[model samples]
Target: MSRLNRSRSFLWLAGTVGVTLLGSLIPLTTNNRFYYYDDTQAGAFGIWFEIGTKLSAGEWPLFSDTAWGAGNYAAEGQWGIWNPLVLLIGWLASTSPNIVVFSTVLKITCLCVLAAGTFLLAGSYKARPEWAAIAGVAVTLTGFTVYIDAASWVTGLMVFSLLPLAWFGLRRMAFAGGNPILALVAAYVLITIGYVHGTLMLAVLFLGLFAEAWLTARSRNVMFRLLLAGMVCGFIALAVYLPGVLTAPVTARTGGIANSGFLTPDLTGLATVWVPGSLPQITGWWGGFAPVPLLYVAWFLPVLAIVDYGRMWAGGKELAAIGVFGLLSLGLTLAPSDLGPLRFPIRLMPYVSLALLLGAAVLLSRYRVAVLSRGRLAVTAAIVISGLYLAWSQYPSIRMAAAFGLLSVAGIGGLYFLLFSPRAAPRLKSPAATAAGVILVSLVVAAGQHAAFKASPLPDYRMPDTPQAYSRQLPGAEGGTFVVGDPTKLGSQIWNETLASNAWYLNSAQVQNLYSPIMFAKYAEDLCITSHGWTCSSAGRKLFETDPATGKVLADLLSLDTVQILRDPAATSDDIFRDGPPAGWHESSRSADAVVWMRDRPLLNTGQVVWASDGTRLSLVSENSQEVVLRVDGLDGGSGKAVLSRLAWPGYSAQGASLAAPLRGYLVELDIPANSVGKSITLRFEPPAWPAVVGSIIIAIVVSLGWSLGELVLLRRRRPDKAWADRAMAEPVKAVSPQ
Candidate 1:
C-alpha cells in the first residue's frame, strides 16, 4: 500500500472507532444517565474512587481498615492498582466533579479501544478496511459485551477490549515477520489487569494463535518468539497474581466446579444469534431471561447467506484456524457453570462473538459476490424466520420476536444493497461508502437496543449519588464505622435519599459496608459478615462480646468509634438497643434510616495492636495501611504475644518480633522474644516474593522493549533494498484469514 493509501486507511479506521464510541454512549445519552447498575455502582466505582483518593493523598492503598474483611486490596487483585492506566483512571474519576460521568467516559474510551483493535485485527487478516470497520462496530455493540460487561463489569470490559490488539500483535509477529514488541506489550498489559477470567481468556487466545502459527508456518523462529512472549507474560502474571494466590486460602474464593446452570447459554439460543433484542432463556442475575441481546453478534451476520462460501474455503489455512478457535470458544461457553477458578461461562461470550465477527469480515472481504439473487434473499428470510421461531419457542414473546425479526431483515437488506446491489451508483459500492452504511446501521441498532435496555425492568437502573452527597449524609468517624444490617435491605436504600449502600468507599467515613468478592473467612465469620461486608442482625451482639484470646470486645479490637444499625420499623424489638446500650456505648442519634451508637472512650492506641500479653506493653508510634511502628516495653524478661486487628494475610513481617500463630487463627499475632522486647518494632506488609516478582517484571519489560526495538532497526536497515522489498511482497501471504 502507498503512503497515501495508508493514511486513508488510518483515517477510515479512526472514523469507525469514533462511530463505535458514539454508538456505545447511546445508553448514557438516550437515558440521560450513566451506566450505574449493580456491580458498576456498588463495586467498581467505589473501588476506583478509593484508589484515587488514597493515591492522591500519597498513600498506597494496599490495605484498608475501613473495608474490614475486604481490606487487602492487593490480595483481591481485581482492584488493578498495579496497572498504571487503571491507576490513572481511578485517580481521574476520584478527582472528577461527577464520578458517574467519568465512569461513563472511561467505559466509552474502552469501547473505542475495542473498536480500533478489532478493526486492526481484521485488516491484518487482509480484510478490506470497510469490512474491518463493519466487524469492529458489530463486535463493539455485541449483546453480552455492551449490556453485561460494559454496563456492569468494567474490569471485564477493560480486559475484553484488549484481546483484539493482542491478537493483531501476535499475528503480525508469527506470520508477517513484524516485530514482536507489540505482542509482548499487549500481552503484558492484558495480564496486568488482574481479572482471572480475562487472564484465562488471554491464555486461550495465546494457545490458539500459537497453534495456528505452528500448523501453518512451522517456522522455528516464529515458534521461539511466540514462546518467548508467552514466557514474559507468565512472569508478569506472577507479579500480578502471586499475592492473590497466596491469600486465597484465607479468603472466601475457594474454587469449585458445579452445573447449577447459572450464566450457561442454551444451544438453542444460537438460532436467534442475529436478533438484536431477543431475550433468550438464559439464567443470569436478572433471573430467567437476559433483558439485553445476550446472543446478538451483529445485525449484518445473517448477510453471510449471500457470501461465496467456496471462495472462503479456498482462502486458506487461517480460516480453518479461526473456525477451530470459534468452536473451542463455543465449547467453553457451553461448559459448566463453574470451570475451576473461572466462573460464569457467559463471560466467554465476547470471545465467541469476536470469532464469529472476524470470520464474517474475512469471508466478506475476500470474496466479492454477485448481486443478491432471489434465492439468496429467500434463504435470508428463512433464516430470520427460523431464528424468530426458535427464540419465541423459549421466550414466547411474539411482539419482541417480531420486532427483532423485522429489524434483522431490514438490516440484511440494507447491507446487501450496500455491498452487492448492481443498481446502486458506483461510489455506493466503494469501501468508504460501504463502511459508512455499516456504521450508520450499526449506530441505529445500538441506539434502539440501548432504548430497549433502558426500558427493561429487569435491571435496577438506580443511579448512585455523588461522592459529596455520601460524605454530607455520613459524617467522618474518628475511628472506623461498623455497619450492622442486611446488605440486601441496605442496598435497596441507595436511591432512597440515604447513605446505606455497599458503596461505603465513597464517603469520608470509614464505613464497613464495602463490597468484595473475596473476604477473609475468619474475619467474615467472627463478625457475622458476608462477602459484601454486610453483617447479620446478630452482628450487633457479636461486636460487644469479648474475645477470649485478646480479652477485648470486638468493637475495641476493630477500633470502631461509631455503629449504625439499620432501623427496621416492623421488628417487634431492637436487638442491641433492646437491652439498653452495652457498657461504654450510648445512642448518639436515630433516624428513619439508621440508629447510630457512639463509643464513650476510644482506644488510645489507634494502631493494630488491640491487646497484649501480661508484662508486655505496646504504644502506637506510627501507622499506615502497609506499615506500622510501635514502641515496646516490659517484654525484656519474658516472651509475650500481641494480637493485631489486622487480618493475617500472607505478607506481614515484624523486625523485632516474630510472627506467632494467628490469634483465633485470623488476627495477626506478634510474638515478642526476650532478646528483642525493648527494641522498637517496625512491621511492614508486601506481597510475598516481592523482590523476585518485581525484578522479573522489570527485566521482562526492558528486555522485550530492547529486543523489539532492535528488530525494528534491523528491519528498517533491510527495507531500503529493492530486492528485499520485492522478496517481501512476493512471499506467499501465509497470514491467517478469519474463519
Candidate 2:
C-alpha cells in the first residue's frame, strides 16, 4: 500500500479504538459496582455463561432439560453457537474471574467492531478516511447503540455491529468488481449471528445495494452475480433458522404481527437527531420518554452545508444508495410495534443513524469545497435554528440544555470549517492537520454525549459481590430446582438476592426458571408460566399432585430436588408451605428474602430417566444434555412406559423403544413393548431436520466457492492484456475514490 493509504488505515484503527474507549468511560465510571443491567444481567450473561461452560467442556449443547422452558438451544436460535466469534467470546468469558468485567470488555470490543465497520462502509462510498472515521465515531456512540443495545440487548448489539461490514462487502462486489468471496463470507457471518432483526436489515441492505447497482452500472453480469450471491445467503439463512422453523408450532414464539406501541418512536423524535443530549418523545423502556437521545445520529450532521448537492445528485451513486437505505430504515423505524417475529421499531434506529451519517460522509467527500458560500451559510444557520426549536418543542423542559447543545454543534462546525476551508492559515490546511481536527472534534462530541446521558438506567438497590455469587448462595440440586417468584416486583434485587430469571443457569442448577424468547408452549401453560419464566402463585401447589402413571408426585416426576419461593408483598397467608412441607419434602432453609424447600428422599437415579411405569424398570447408564443411555430390565411380556425428565422438544428419538405420546403433556415418554427386556436403549435429541439443514449449508458453501473460482479465472485472463489494463485505469471509479 502507498504511504497515504497506510496512514489512513492506521488513523481509522486508532481513532475507532480511542473514541470507543473515551465515549464508554462515563457509564463505566458512574456504575463501577456493575456495568451490566436489565436484560443483560438477568438473561444474556447467564445464558452465555452456560453456553460457554458447555462448549469449554467439549460439549455441543443443543438441548438442556436443566434450563426447562429454554432448553432447546438450537431451536431458540439466538445462542449464536454457529458463529466462531461468539464461541471465542463465550469460551474466554467462561474462565474469567469477574463476569461483570468480562462482559464490560466484551461490550467495549463490540463498540470497536461497530466503529471499524462503519469506517470501512463509508470508505467503500469513496469518503475520505477522516470523514469516514468521524462517521464511525458518531454512529458508534448513538444513543440506541450505547444505552439500549449495549446496556441490555447484547445479542442485538453483536448482530448490529456487523451490519456495516456486510454492507461494505455487498457494495464492493456489486459496484467495484471486487472478489465475491468476501461478500459471501460477510453475509454468512452476519446471518449466523442468529439475531432475526439483523438478518432482516441485511435483506433490506442487499435490496438497496442491488437496486443502486442496477440503476447506475446497468451491468447484467454484476446483477446476475449479486442475485446469485443473495440466493446463496438465503440458503445459509435457512440453515440457521431451520430448527426454529420446525419447532415453531410448539414454541411460544409462534405469532403474527401485532403492534403494542411499546418502544415505538414518535415522528417528532427525528427533530432531536442533531441535539446531543436532548431526550426524544418516545415510548421507551423507561416509559413516556427516553432518558437518552435514542434518535441522535451526529451533532455535525447539520454542518455539511458546504457540500455541492447538485453535483452530487448528478454523479453520486453512493449517495443515492445511502438515501434509499435511509428511507427504508426510517419507514421500518416508524412501522408497527411488532412486524412478524421482530418487535420494537426503535431497534432499527442504529441502522437509520448509520445510513444518515454515511450519506453525510459521501456527500462531503464528493463535493465539500474549501470555502462556505453566503447562501450555504444562510442555509446552515436556518437548519441549526430549526433543529433547536423542534427539540425545544418536543421537550419543553430542557430548553436550556437544547440551546447549549446547538451552540456546541456550531462551535465544532466553526472549528472544522476553519481548519479545512480557505479562510484558515496554509499550515492548518494540510491533510494531517485536518484529519487531527476531525478526530478531536468527533471524540469531544462523543464524550459530551456520554456525559449527558449519565449512567445506564440501572437500579442502585442491588450489587453483585462476585461472578460466582449466585452459585455460592444457592445450593446445587442433583434433581432440578424450581424458583417461584415475580422478577418484575423484585426489580434489580433479582440479580443478587434470589434465584430468579436466568440466575439458576449461573449456579449450574437445573431450575424451572428460564430466560428465552422461545419456550415450550405446553410446559409453560401447564405451570401457568410467563415468557420471562415467572410462574403463577399456585404453581407450587400444582407440583404436589401425584402422577397417575407412576404414582410419583409431580415434583418427583419432574426430578425436582429444590424449591425456592421469594418473599414479597404478594405472599399470602395460605402459601404453599404454610401448612408445612408435604409428604417426602422438608423445609431446608429460610431467610428474610426467600424460603428454600428440599426433597427428603431425593430420587435414587438422578439421571435422564426419572420415572418408569409399574411393568417397566430402567437403570441409568450415562447421560448428557443431548443424549441418555439406559438399561431396561423388567418389561417382560407387557407394554409399559418410561418417562425422561426432558422437555418434549420435537427432535428426540429412541433406538430400542417407540416414541410414546408426551407424558402429562411435557416430559419425553418412551413406550417399552412386550419383548423389551434386559436391552440397552439410547435416546438422542438432534435438531429435527438436521439432514436438510446441513445440506443447505454445504450447498451454499459449494456454490459460493464455485462462483469465486470462476471470477478468479476471468480476472487472471483479463490481467494479461494491455488494453484491459488501460481501460480499467481510465474507467471512472464507481465505488471508491482514486485518492
Candidate 3:
C-alpha cells in the first residue's frame, strides 16, 4: 500500500467519525435523555434486556409462562439467542441491568461497527482514501440508517454494520480465490438475522451476493467456491438456524409475512443523509422538504460513479453493479406483486445505502472529473433519473407519484455541477474539493431539516429503578397466568420499566397471533398497541369488562390468578377501586406503582382430571408451568378429560392416556380412562427435548471449529490447492479473522 493510501485511510476515519458525531450530537450530548425511538422502547430494548437478565439467572428461556402459557424463546426469530453477542448481553444484564445504558451503548457499537465495515469493504477494492471514506460516511448517513437508529432496531443495526465486512469476505472468495473472513461474518449473520433488516433484509443480502457471483465470476469454479463459502457460513451457524426454521412454522411464524410494498424512492431523500446531526434520519415526512438545501451530495456521487465506470470496470469491479442492485430492489418494491413478500421496501434501504456509497467510492477513487465529457455526464444523469422516475410512477396513489416526481426534478437540478461544471480539477484537488462539498452540503441540509422538523426526542424519563418501576408481587403469579393492569395499561408497563414483560410479543407467537406463516413474528395481540398503532399481544391485560359469570371462569380456564392495578397518573381520574380490579378478587397490598389484588379463589392448580361420563371434575394434586398431576379413581370405570388450564401449543401429552389437541382455542384437554383413575396421571407440555438440540449445537460447533482450524493450518502451510478454486501459482487467499 502507498503512503498516500495509509494517510488517506486515517483521514477517512477522522473525517467520517467527526461528521457522524456532529450528526448525532443531540442524542450523545443530551444527559437528560438517550435515543429510544418509541417503537423499540418496549418491543426491542426492554424485552431483550429482560431476556438477558433471565438467561443469566439460569431460567429456561424456550418455554416462558410470564405472559402466555408457553412463549418459545429459541423460536423467536428476533431474539437471536443462538448468537453469541445476544447471549453475552443477556449474561451481562443479569448482573447489572440498566436498559438505557445497555441500549445506548449497543446503538453506538452498531454505528461504529457499520463505519468500520463500510471502510474496510470500500478499501478492499483498492479505492483511494477519499472514495473509501466517502463510501463509509455516505452509507452511514442515509434515511435507511436514520430510521433504523431512531426506531432502535438493534438487530438491524448490527446486521447492517457487519454487512460491508461480509460482502468484503464474499468479494475476496469470489474474486481472490477464498478468504476466512467470509466464513466468520457469514456465520455471525446467519446466527443473527434481524440486523440486516430482519428476515427479508438478510435474503436481499444473499441475493445481492448471488448476483455478484452470477455477473462477476465467469468461472464455474469461482461460483462453486462462493457456494461453498455460503455453506460453510450456514454450517457454522446451523445450531441456531436449524431449530429456528423447524419451530418457526408451528409457532408464530408460519409462511413468510406479506409486509412488502409502498416505499417509493424519494429522489430528494438521496441527499438526506448528508444533513448534519439527526436531520437526515428524522421521522415523519416534512412534505419531503424538511431538510431540503437546494443542493445535495446524491447528485454529485452517482454522476461521479457513472462517469468513472470505465476505470472501475477496468479494476475488475463486480461489486459496483452488485451494490446498485439495491436500487433495483426499490423498483421491484413499487410493484404490487411484491418482491416474493418481503418485509418492506424501506427494509432494502440498508442495501441501497451501501450500494450508493460504493458507487460514490468508485467516483472518488481518483476524482478526475475532468476525464468525463459534459455529454457523458449529462447522459448518465438522465438515465439514472429516468429509472427513479419510472419507479415513482408505479406508486398506487397520485399523491405518492407527485411527491416522487418532484424529488426527481429536484435531484436533476442538483446535478448541474456534475454535468456542466468546467471548474473541476483533474488531480488531488478534485477529490479534496468533492469531499469538502459533500460534507458542507450534508451539514447544511441536516441542520435545515432539524430546524424544520425535529424528530421527537427520547423521553426525558429514566428507566424504572424504584419500586414504582416494578410490577406488583403475586405469590400465585410466578409460573402461572397473571394480569398487571386493565387492557389499556397492559403492555404499556412491559416496555416502560422492565426489559422483559410477561407478554407474547416474542416471535413464535403462532402466525395466527401475528397473521404470518414463514416469516418470524415478534409478538402477538393488540390489547396493547405501539405508538405507531401496531397492536401487540399481551395475555396479561385485564378483561375488557369482567363478565360477571364468565370472567372468573375464563380466568380459571386460562390459569389467570393475580392482577396488579398500576397507578397511572392519567388513570387517577378513573376509579381504580372499580375499573382497575376484576371481580372475585381482594386487594392484597399497595406498592409505589401498583395496587395488588389476589383472586379470592386462586387458580394456582387448575389442572383437573374430570370423569367425562359422570361429568365430575377431580382436584389437581399439584402442578407447575409445564406439568400437572391429577389423581383420579380409574377403577371407577368412567372415561374422563385431564383439563389443564393453559393455552394449547404443539408437543403436549398426557401420560398413560390419550391427548386431544384443543380446538376452539381452549385450554389443553387430555382424555383419561376410568380404569386408570386410581393411578396418578401427569400432563406435561413436552416440546422437543433440550438434550437433542444441545447435542446438535455441540456437533455443529465441533464441525465448524474443526474446519476453521484446518483452514488455519492450511494458511500456515501455504498450500495453493486448486481443490477449492485457486489455481496453482495463484496467490493464496489471505485469511480473515473471525469478526
Candidate 1 TM-score, true structure as reference? 0.91
CA lDDT, every prediction? 0.74, 0.74, 0.48
* Candidate 2 C-alpha lDDT tens digits along 503-547: 556775667788878878888887778866878767888888887
Candidate 2 wrongly placed segments (more than 4 Å): 33-35, 304-306, 369-375, 399-404, 412-422, 428-442, 458-465, 487-497, 546-552, 577-579, 604-623, 628-642, 654-664, 670-682, 703-716, 720-739
How far in Å is the alpha carbon of 635 misplaced in model 2? 6.2
| lDDT of each residue in 1-739, candidate 1, tens digit only | 5666556777867887888877877777666444555677767877787788889989776776546677777778888766877788778878878756777788888889998888888777767777788888888888888777877778888888988888887777767667777778777777777878778877787778777776677888778878878887888888888888887888877778888888899888877788777778888767888767888888777777877677666655666557767888889899999765567898889989999998888777766466567887898888877877887887787777676667777777777877666688998877788888877777787777776676322344364547666665445355777777753553455333334334667766666667778888877887877765667788888888888776788788777788877644445565663555778877776666667787788653444788888878888788977788888867744878888777787888999888988876777888887755557888888877778767878878887888888887798665423232122222212332322
Worst 10 residues of 1 by lDDT: 724-733
Off by over 4 Å in 1: 307-311, 368-382, 417-427, 455-465, 487-502, 568-574, 577-579, 604-606, 635-637, 674-677, 680-682, 720-739
Model 3 lDDT tens row, 308-417: 44544665445644564666655543333233323334455566657767756644453334445556667756655554444333222355334433543444344445
Best-to-worst TM-score order = 1, 2, 3
Q: Name the better of 1 and 3 by lDDT.
A: 1
Better of 2 and 3 by lDDT: 2
Top model number, lDDT = 1
